[model samples]
Target: MSAIMSGAISMGILAWIWANLSAAVGVSTWAGFMGTTTYYASGERFIKGWVKGMIANMVGVLWAIICVEVSKVLHVPNIVAIMTGVISFGIVAEAKWKNLSFVPGVYIGCSTTFGMLALNGTYLSTVVALLMGSVVGLLSDAGGELLVRLTNKKETEENLVEKQG
Candidate 1:
């Protein structure tokens, strides 16, 4: 099967088993798509981008949950949630981190935060769902990597057989 298909299958099974995991499913799907595209570019680049994207999604979701939880504890107005999310993004953007250079980490944080808040999800559940999503994305990437390797091996074997026969 194709790498994208592998990722979809992995995430699909996760979503089917756990309804809450759907929160991260959209990001996971994109990660799978990006992974497949990167693989076409080069195997090394695929692995690097896939890992970085998954990590960024996890960090972003965590940061967003933190902001939302803080706002809830402080009894702040709903507007504060937006401010908190944007500020969190700024902090992440300015921070000195190698992985931050790739992936839309800030956007991920902002969107996840706002989306969860808009949905009126509790702090704990929101965090749990988002974390699960990130893990699923990572798993999907690994599946994609395995598919690529298997495909390459199969092609090599076919080429050898053709040359011999």
Candidate 2:
């Protein structure tokens, strides 16, 4: 499991982040996917990791419900539900790539889809959602590895010195 934040804790953070994000953007899907990725990446035992992931998502869904309730009060008329779901799913996809190369585009597409479409096509939203999910998983995995390097805090002046390209 990854370390910057422990597995369950990371899930909570992911949930919190996603919930807030969805509330702000009128979507809640991407939050749990990203949380699950962290659950896998975090340093828990394999079975424990899966359990944490499931539980974390259970809590996240509850949070989503809360967001839904709030939206009723705010009267924002969320057209972006699909976008939130897609981007939330994107969190799982980004887990595999730390550099997040595809993330920005996916986020835009996912976010826009929710904003604009009422009943989005399976052909388009589903495809984009899956692609975005994969992207997020990739990025999350890469991000963990990168954080490891960053936190090692190794080296001295020589390490900082630039090498010839």
The candidate scoring highest on lDDT is 1
Full-model lDDT for every candidate: 0.53, 0.43
* Model 2 C-alpha lDDT per residue in residues 74-138, reported as the tens digit of each score: 65556346435644675457546643333333343343333324354332443333333333444
Listed in order, each prediction's TM-score against the native is: 0.53, 0.30
Q: Model 2: how large is the Cα RMSD against the reference?
A: 14.8
- Model 1: per-residue Cα lDDT over 43-145, one tens digit each: 2333464456545545655666666566667765675757675666665675577755443543454455566667664444444444554455455557666
Lowest summed lDDT window (length 10), candidate 1: 34-43
Weakest 10 consecutive residues of candidate 2 by summed lDDT = 126-135
